[model samples]
Target chain A: MSFDIALWLVQDGVTNGAIYALLALAMLLVFAVTRVIFVPQGEFISYAALSLALLQAGRLPGVVYVLVGGGLVAAALDIALALREKAPARLPRIVALYVLVPCVMAALAWWAAPRSVGLPLQVLIVLGLVVPLGPILYRVAYQPLASASVLVLFIISMAAHYALTGLGLVFFGGEGLRSEAFSDARFKLAVLDITAQSLWVVGASFVLMFALRLFFEKTFYGKALRATAVNRIGARLVGIPAELSGSLSFLLAAFIGAVSGILISPITTIYYDTGFLIGLKGFVGAIVGGMGSYPLAVAGSIGIGLLEAFSSFWASAFKETIVFTIIIPVLLWRSLRSRHIEDEEE
Target chain B: MKHRLFTALALAGSMAAGSAYAEITIGVSLGSTGPGASLGIHYKNAYQLMPKTLGGEPVKYIIIDDASDPTNAAKNARKLVSEDKVDALMGSNGVPSAIQMAQVAAEAKTPMMVLTPAILSPAVAHWSFIVPQTTELMMGAIAEQMKAKGIKTVGYIGFSDTWGDLVLKATEFHAQAAGYKVVTNERYARADTSVTGQVLKIIAANPDAVIVGGSGTGGALPHVALVEKGYKKPIYHNHGTVNAEFIKVGGKAVEGAVAVTGPLIVPEELAANFPTKAMSLDFTRRYEASFGAGSRNGFAGYAYDGYLLLNAAVPEALKKAKPGTPEFREALRGALENVKNLVGTHGVYNMSAANHNGLDERARVPVQVQNGTWKLMK
Candidate 1:
C-alpha cells in the first residue's frame, strides 16, 4: 500500500502543499493588517521568482543579494513615499509605497538584463523584491486611505497587480523562462527520479517558512505587529508604532513570497502572470485556514497543494475541475452556516 | 489607448477599399489581440505572397480576432462562416483555441484550416485540414528518430495543460510502441516555479533519456533544474520548447537536448530555383524584420503557409469563375480542392475533397539546440 502510486501522490501533494501554504501565509499577513485582498500579491511571487533566477544565474553570493535587493527596494519606497505628503510628519506610511515601482523595476532590470544573470538568479531577484512590496504599499498607501472604504483599497490592490503584470511583460517579455537552478543533476530509481536541487529547494522552503512563523510569533516585532492587527489605535497609544508593524508584516510576507518564487522557479517557469494563479491559490489557502491565522494559513496552503496533487494523480484529466468544484461546495456550506448563525443571533 | 488606435487606423486607411471581388467573402478568425496576434502579420503577408507566386486573382479576405479565448474563438469562427459569409476558414495558434475553432468550422462546413500543433479529436471540417507537422506529428518524428538511435528508456515532464497532455500521450505511445522503456511521467501546475522534485524523480528512475513535452519554456524547466541538482541525461524537446528565450534562460543547460521543428523558414539559397523561388525565404526575412528574433516558432511557419495556400486558391477560383456571375463564388470553392504540390514553408502543400492536412513526418526536421542557436539534427 505504501508503495502504491496513491501513496506517492499523497507524499507529492504534501510536499507541494507546503510550498503553496507558505505563499498563502505570506498573503494572510497583509490581509490581517489591511482588509484589501491584494490581487497584486501574485505578481510579487512572479517578480521574486524572476529576481531569484537573475541573482542565482549571476552567481551573486548566497542569500545576501536577495536580502540586499529586497531591502534596497523597500527603503527606496519609504523615502519616495515620505516625500509625497504635504506635511511629511503628518502623512501615513501606507500611502507612500507606490514610490518603489521604478526603483524595484530598475533594480530588477539591472540584475536580469545587461548583467545577463541566469534564470535561477532572475527568480531570486523577483522573489526578493516582491517580499517588501505588499508591506511598503501598506505603509505608504493603506495608512492614508484608512478612512476610505474597502472598495477603494480593493481597487488599489487590483491596480497594483495590473501595473506589475503589465510592466513585467513589457520588460521581461511574455514567454516563461527556464531557470538554470537545475541543469545537470540526476539519480534514478525504478520509476522515480529525484534531483538534489529539487530536494534542496523544497527543504529550504520548509525550514524558512517555519522559521518565519516563529519570528512573526515569538519575536518582539512579531508581537507588535500582532498587537497592531488587533487594536491599532491602542497599540499606537502604547507606543507600538502601528504603521511600522504593518510595514513589518508586508515585508515579512514579501520575503516569504520571494523565497517561494525562488524555490518554485526551477519547476514552474517564471513568467509575468505567474502570480495570478499562485496569488489566487495562496488567497484561497489563507481563507481555508480561517484568514489572519498564520498557522492555519500554512495548514490551508498545504491542503490546497495536496488536493491539487491528488486531483492530478487520480482524476488526471479533471484536476482543475476538482479543485474549483470542491472549493465551491465547501465555501457555500461554511458561509451559509455562518449566515444562519448570524441570523439566529440577530 | 489613442496611440494604439491611431496606429491601427493609419495602417487600415493606407490599405483601405479592397478591390471588388465576386467570390463569397470568407471570414478568417485568429488572435486579434495580445501576443498570439503576432502571427496575424504572417497571415497578412501570406495574402500578398499568393498573387505573384500562384497567379491567383484577388478574393475578399476577412480576418477576425478571437481575443485569446477558446469560447471567443468559437464565436469568431461562427461569425466569420455564418454571418460574414466566408467561403472557408482557419484559426487558432495552439491546442486550446484550435479545439474550439475546429468545432465551429465543422458544423459550418467552412473548409477550415487549423494552423496549430494540436491533434483534432476527430477531424473538424467537412473539409478541415490541420496544418502539417502538428505538435504530435513533429514529436512522433523525434520519437521515431530516437527509436532508430536505440535510445529506449525515457522520462517525460511538462506543465499540466492541454498541449502538455498531447505531447505526453503522443510521445509515450510512440516511444512505448517502439520498444522503449517507460520510466517517469510528471506534470506541474502553470504557476509552479520549482519542479526539481519531479525532475529528481525522473533522475532517480535513471531513464536512458528524457522527453520534455510542454509548450514554450515550461518544457525545458526540468532540464535546467535537473542539471543544477546534478542530473545528466539526453533530453528530447518538443517544438515550443526549443526557442532562443528558453535556451537563453536554460543557458549552458540546453546543449545536447534534441527538438522537433520544421524548416519552414528556409534561406533563399535553400529554396528550389523554381518560379516561386525565394517565396519562403522572403516570408521568413520579412517576418523576422518586423517581429523580433525568436518570433518564428513552429506555429508561425504553418500560419504563414496557410495564408499562401488560401491566396493561391483565389487565383485558381478566378480562372474557373464565369465573370459577372453568382456562380463565380461557387466556382472558387470548387477550384480550392485542386491545390497540390504548392510548395509552402514546410513542403509542397496538398488538399483533396477527403483530406485537409497537407504534410506528414517527411516534412518535419528535428533540430538540436547547441549552445544558444538551433542546430539541425545530425
Candidate 2:
C-alpha cells in the first residue's frame, strides 16, 4: 500500500477504534461493578441507533414500548421485594425511578416521534428511550441474581444478549438502517481525506472518557461504585448500597453505548445483531486489559482496531479469525503473568 | 355403546377418504429471523400472496423459521417431510441453509424448490430444483455490461461465505470470456461494520470498476465505502443487492450504482412482447400492494416463480398418484424436470434433466439507481 492509502486506513482504524474504546470502557465498568460481563451492551448501541433512525423517519420507535414494558416489570419486582421486606419507606423512590420516569420518557417519545423534530431533538429522544433500558434490565435480569457466582451471571448476560437481539429484530425489523451524518464537512489532511463524522466519533469518545474519569474521581456516587468494585461486601457494610452502585454503573454504561451508537450509525449500516460482534470486539479489548484497567483496555481496543484494519487489507477472509485468535495468546500470557487469587465468592 | 362405536368408526373411515383428495401440503423453511431475515421475510410474504390451490387442488403451506442456520433448515425439512407429510418442500433464502434442505429433500425422496441460487451436488440436484437464476447466469449479465462499457480491470469485494465464493467463481469464470482482468479479490463478513481497508486496497489496485458481490443491506457497505473514498468509475452489483432496503441504507451514496437483477424489479419497463412481462407486472403489483410500494424484491419473485413451476407440474404429477404418496413426489420431480416454456415473474423457465435452474439471459435486466429509484437501463 502507498503512504496515502496507509494514511486512510489509519484514519479508518482510529475512527472505529474510538467507538470500540467507548464500548470497552463500558464493558469494563459494568464488569467491575457488577461482576457481570454485560454481553448486551452492544444491544443498547443498536437500539439507540435504530431508535434515532425511526424518529428521523417520522415513525414512533418501537423501543419506547420495550422501555415501558421493562420498567413495569422492574417496578413490579422492586415493589414485591419491598413489600416482602415490609419496607414501605423505599416504595415511593422505586415508583418514581422505575415507574414514573419511563412513562414520562415514553410519553415524550410518542409526542416527538412525528413532529420531524430535527436531528438534535431526535437524538435526545432516542437516548431517553434507550438509556433507561439499561437500569431497568439490571433490576429485572441481574438484581435478583445479584449474589450468584460470576459464571452464573455470565450465563444470564448471554441470555439477556439473545433476548435483546430478538427484541431488536422485533423493534427495528430485519432491515439495516443508517442515519444522516451529524455533519457533512470533509477535511483533507496531508494525503488523506477524512469526513467530519469520524472526528465526531473520536472527539465524543474522548470527551466521554474524560467525563467518566472525572465522575469516578470527583463524584460521591462514582466513588461508591469504585468502592463496590473493590469489595462489594465491605462497601455494603460501610453503608454503600450495592444495588444502587450496580444500577448506576449500568446507567453510565448505557449512556456510553448510546453515544457510541449515535456516533457510528451514520458511518455504517447497523442491523439488529450487529452490536454483538462490535461488542465482542470490545470484549476482546477488555480481556487484553485483564478486564480491569481502563487505560489498558482503551489502548488494547485501539490496537485491535488497527490490527483489524491492517489484517482486512492483507487477508480479508481471515480478518475476524485473526482478530479473535489474538485473544487466545493474550489470555495465555495474562494467565501466566498474573498470580491466581482464590475465589472471592468462596 | 357398541352401536355408537361402530357409527364413529364408519364416520372416521369416510372422513379419512374425503380428506385424502382434499388438500396438498407444501413445507416451507426460510431464515425468517436471523442474518438473512431481510430476504427471508420477503420470501415468506410471497407465500401469503401465492394462490391457495395448485392444479385445481387446495393446497396448504407449512412455513417454518430456520433463523438463517443450516442445521435448523435441515431439521425443518426433515420434520416437514416426515411429520407434516408434505408432498413437496420449498424454502430458505440463504444458500447454505437451502443446500442443507436440499440434502434432506434428497434423503427423504421429496421434491424441493429452493428459493436461493444454491449449487447442489449432482446426487441431490435431481430432487431439488433451484428457483432463482444461478450465479453464473446472473454474473454473466454483469460481465456483458462491463464488456459493453470497455472496462479492463475490475475490483471485487464480497462476503466471505458461500455466496461470496459463488460470485467470485462466477466473476472469474466470465472474466476470461469477457476479455477483462479481475485485479483484486477482497471479502468481508456480512455483519462487518466497515470496509475501509478493503476499499483502500481496491483503490490502490486502481481497477477500472468495482463489482460488489454482497447481498441484502450488507452489500451497501462496500459500495458506500467506495463512493466515500472517491472511487467514481463504476460500481456493479449482482442480483442479490437489488432491493429497496439496500437503497434505503445506502441512500445518496448508492446513487448511480448499477446492478443486474430479475426483470420483476422493473416490470413496468418490460416490453409487452416480453414473455414474462404480464406475470411480472401482476406479481409485482400484488406484492407491492400488500407490502406497500417500493417493497418489490427479487427474493419474493423467486418464491412466486417457484409456485408457478409447481403449479404447472402438480397436475401432471397428480395424474400418476395421490397427493400424499411418495410416488406423487417422484412424479412431481419428473414433471418439474420436464417443464417447458413455463412463464413466471422473473423469466421463462425450461427445466431439463441436466439443468435445474432454467433461467437464461432473458431473466436479467440491468438497472441503475436514479433519483432514488431503480431505473431500467436499456
Compare the candidates by TM-score and give the number of the best one.
2
Candidate 2 lDDT by residue in tens digits, B1-378:
999999999999987886776589999999989899988889999998987899889899999999999999999999999999998999889899999999999999999998999988999998999999988888998999999999999999999999899999999999988989999999998778789999989988999999999987889999999998889899999989898888888999999999999999999998889888999999999999999999999999999999999999999999999899899999999999999999989999999999998888899999999988888998
lDDT of 1 at B170: 77
Candidate 2 chain B weakest lDDT stretch, 10 residues: B14-23
**Fraction of native contacts (fnat) of each candidate:** 0.34, 0.66
Per-prediction TM-score: 0.73, 0.96
Which ranges in model 2 have alpha carbons more than 4 Å from their true place? B1-22
Q: How well does model 1 score by local distance difference test?
A: 0.63
Tens digits of per-residue lDDT for model 2, A103-168: 999999889987987899888888988899989999999989988888899999999998999998
